[model samples]
Target: MKLSHIKLYPLAIPLIEPIKMSGETITHANTLLVYLKTNTGKEAWGETSAAPLMTGETLGGLLQNAKYLGEHLRGLDITELNSISMVLGKILYGNTSVKSCFEMAIIDLFAQAQDTSVWQILRDLSKNKTQTKPIPLPLLRMLGGSLDKEVADAALYRAQGYRHWKIKVGSLPLAEDLERVSILCDLLAGDIVSADANGAFNLDQAVIFCTAEKTRQLSFVEQAIAAKSTIDDFSLLKSKSHLPIALDESIHDVNEIKYFDQANALDGASLKLIKTGGLVSGLAAALELQRRNLKINLACKVAETSLSAAATASLGFAIDSIPWGFSMSNQYLEFDICAKPLHAENGHLNIEQLNPIGIGVTPEINLVTQAHSKEYSTVLC
Candidate 1:
């Protein structure tokens, strides 16, 4: 099938609550939703979330790049999917989220044409060994609000079978943060508690905090230092601290995996479609990390909607080993704009539910109508 048109929808969907990180606070999900149309009247949807702190992509930049990509993608034959990706890679640089958004739509449409799911198509194309059946993945709940609020939230999620919890540190005072983590570690005695600094701590502070006895209960520590810190700094922290390190903000290109692996700087990596560009690229990165025996934290953008969450679920299932991560963005959203909601049950995402053709869900008609009425929708051909 040949591409006929590409429509971009810019949206500011509200989150259930503001997500405060080290340097930023997110109250709404500023994202771009792309609708790809084929000459045969088939349609596929994709989504890209903009996070300036994480991916260095602002809302305005994503919209511009989405329009530019749509202009360049017209008349490209969807059958030659590799060629489409190559063309996108050459058009511009660093708009990973925008590139991923289009790639998702293309893959979604291709799966629909083949009467299969994105998971099946990716697995069939993959050279790595993957499971034949969907494996249930452990979900990581983000600790929100005050310590009392977090305790209450953790208790509720714990009752629901969630074993992994991630707390946002680096924004609070060291004493308060340590106290909060200690309380959580005690409350979740047998479960995993990870502290993500969002690249807020310096090497010394990270080393100090990570080496503390109170923080010893953590399953791992993520992005403790700044994203701009040198590899040597991470290596030093890795050597000095007992906690296993997982790189999130520091990982963008797949090449970084080799660098970190060589330096022994990290024991795990967080793979997100917005950071890796698309499903195909993200899966490739995950396979490489698995080959090196590095743990994979398969996650989503903080304020993602159901479209990307559905996409993440499909990709996670095709992996040879299910990573200890969460694709539960829909649960954090006030409401998903999809006709079929992709919700997790009992703190686990059952991959079997995402086996439907394409990305497993379609946009809600009313959501589309609202975007158009608000003049946030654009058609480029």
Candidate 2:
């Protein structure tokens, strides 16, 4: 089906609690929501969040870039999944978040046109020949809020069979963060738990935190030092720390992953659709990580509605293993793009049952229209 229309909505859905991490506090999911219509009258939705520190994309930038791509891609066929992303990449330099949202829209529409699921597209793109057993992926919740609230949430989620956990460190002082991690690790004993510094640590502080006796119980530590920090710095930190180290911001492309691996600086990485340019690219990166025996954590940005969460969950099915866990972020939102938003229950996400067609979810445009964070043209592309 030919692409007939495109619309961009800049949204700022409030978060239940601020997602506090190293050097950042995101209280709302400032994002661009793309509403697409095909010549056949098929409609689909896609979204991307504003992560200035992580991805260097703001809401204003997301709105403008998405609008431009939508206009340029007006007459293209949504069936050309790979070409659409390539075109966006070539036309625009580095608004990966915007490109990701556009890719999500096209892929969602493409899968719907084929009467199949989005994962089928990514699975075909994957080069891995390993057989995959269909199992429900565990949800990794954030423990980044206040200490009392985090502890309370941990107990509640643990009772509900939640096992995977990630603590938001790098915001508070090093010793305090270490003590806090120690407390949570003790509370979450026997759980697959990790701490994300969000590139907040200096090499010395990171080594100190990782070497602390309490933090040693952690399953792994992620992006401890800054992205600007040298690979040798990461190697030093990795060697000094007692637990395994993973890189999120530091490893954007496959070459970086290989470089870090050769430098012996990381054990795993966090993969996001926005970071990798699109779902197809994200799957390719995941396959590379898997081939090299690196841990793969499929995640969304800080705060996003289920539209992006559904996209993330859909992509999770193509990967052979997700030992690091899936980070679907819709649960953090105070509002959703639609009444029937996708979500995980009992700490696990079952993708097929959630949406049997395409990406299996749709958004309520009426609600999304009112959730605008900034005024932008909803002009038909």
Candidate 3:
């Protein structure tokens, strides 16, 4: 299908509740939604949340890049995704977030043209070596906010069949955070558990935190240290670690993936569409990680919509393994733009049920445009 036009919608999507991280508190997700129209009169949607600290692209940058790429990429065969990604990389230096938005939209468009669901296409693209037998999804749920909230949410989610968990850490004193983790680990015993500091700790702090007795039961620790960490730092962190450690913010390209794999620094790497730029590159990164026998953790930026959540979840069908599980951030949203939104039931997202065709979403234009509560923050185009 020929790419005819592109449009961008910026919305400040509020979360159901504010989730506090290390330094920042995310109350609303500044999301940029992309809409693509093919010359064949087909439409598809893509999503990206502004993660300046993680992806280094702000919401405004994503908007401008979308317009620029839309103008340059018009009239081209969008099914030629490789060529499109090449042009995107060639003409631009960074801004992977916006590029990912377009690439994701293009894949949705391509799948629609092929008269198939995105999951089928992505699953078919997986190599035979990367295929895996059916396994239960250890869908990851984060424990944020006060200890009361954390404890209450854990009990609530446990009753709902959430067996996998991540304790959001590093904002409080180490001992207090450890107490929270200890309480949750005990409360949610016999469940798969982990802790994520979101790169808020120092090397020394990371060493102490991972080696702590309370964190012993954790399945893994993610981004324990700062983002500017070196390979040696990660290696050292892993050396002191009693449990497996995964890298999130430190990963951007294949080199970082290879460096950590080669150095035996991390057991898993978190793969996000914004970080990989699109599903094409995301699959490439997944294959690379699988080749090295590293754990794959496909995630979305916090508080994204169902479109991104569905797109990210569809990847589970293609990957070799998701030992760390899926973090589809749409669950954190108060409202979703998609007419039929995908929500997790008993901890698993039945993606096949959602996406009978194309990226599993048919977003309403009105809802898409008015995603923000404040009309001024909503972009018309």
Candidate 4:
């Protein structure tokens, strides 16, 4: 079907309560919603949030890129998403968020046209490759920061039946970070814990932190150093730590996965749909990681909404090869803007049977009036 029009909606969803991470407290989230319409009367939806601190792309930049993409997308065939991505990639230097938003919209469109769920499409693609069965998706508990409040927050999450927790570390002094982890480990003794440094530590520091007794409490460590830095440092640190390491910012696209594989830089990789540009690319990266016997973690930025969360859930179930970080259960502590809530039950999230195809979300425009827009979008592509 021919693409007809594209529309963008900018919305800000307030956090139920402020979330503290790496010394910063977040009060609200800003997300951009993209709508794609086809001549066949099929429509699909996609969502993305701007995170400048991590990715270096802002909301304004995302909007500009979306507008440019919309222009190029007009009248084109909907089935040519991969080709479109290649063409767009050549023109735009880097804007994974933009590409991701559009790519998901395309997927949604395709799924709607085929009258099937996204997961079904993914299953068909993977049927011949692996013997593993699709594992149930789990609700991700995010341990905000290494503060007193963070400890309290983690305890509350444990009380709520969350089995897995992703802790934000690396911003603290090594001693303090270790102390916090020790406290958390003691508090949530049986829970699975993971640590994310957000690229704040170098090789030496990562080694020291990972080798520390406190880190032994974690299932894995994430992005200890910046992705732009050489993987040699990661390899060296990984060799010494002897603990599982998951690279986040390090693997930007499917092609870049080979570099990490060659360096043997990490034990697992955090594949964000936005970071890989969409489900297709994200799946390609996950499959490549699987080929090397590496694990995968589906993660998201803080600014995502239920629409984005649902899209993530679809992808999570599609690739049963790894654990996923659908942190929406933790982030949506406040009321959700979507008509249907993406809540977790017994630390697990189940995908709904097809109803509203493609992202399966409809934003409540009335609630947008209550949203705060003071925060400017950061570039976190």
Pick the lDDT winner.
1
Against the reference, the lDDT scores of all candidates come to 0.83, 0.82, 0.81, 0.70
TM-score: model 2 vs. ground truth: 0.95
Candidate 3 Cα misplacement greater than 4 A, ranges: 129-136, 373-381
lDDT of 4 by residue, 1-381 (tens): 677877776656777666665535666676677777788788777777777766666677677787777777778774553465675576566788888887777777776777776665665565534445446577678776336877788778667777788877876687888887878877777666788888888778888888888778787888888776876787787788856888887787767778777787788888777688777777778778878888777776775766677677676777664553555532553665666666666676666522445555656655543442444331212
Candidate 3 or 1, higher lDDT? 1
RMSD of each: 1.7, 1.8, 2.1, 3.6
Worst 10 residues of 3 by lDDT: 372-381
Global lDDT for candidate 4? 0.70
Candidate 1, 1-381: lDDT as tens digits: 888978887877778899889899988778788988999999989999888988888777888889988888888775665665687888767688999999999998889888998888777767645546767777789997989999999999899988988999999988788889988999998887899999999888899889988888999999999879988998999999889899999887679999998998998888899999999888888888888988888888887778898888777777746555864666787667876677757778787666488988788858755533243556564
Candidate numbers sorted by lDDT from highest down: 1, 2, 3, 4
Best by TM-score: 1
lDDT tens digits, residues 1-381, model 3? Answer: 777767778888888999888867899888888788889799888888889788877777777777777777778774564676887887677788888887788888778878887766777777544444324345789889889999999999888878878888999998998888888898988787888899999999899889988878788899999878887998989988998989999887688899787888989889998998888778888888888888888898987888888778777766636878888787888888977677777887664446677887778887776685453343323
Residue-level lDDT tens digits of model 2 in 221-320: 9998899998789999988889889889876767788898989898899988888887887877787788899898989998888888888877787774
| Model 2, backbone clash pairs (residues 3+ apart or across chains), number | 0
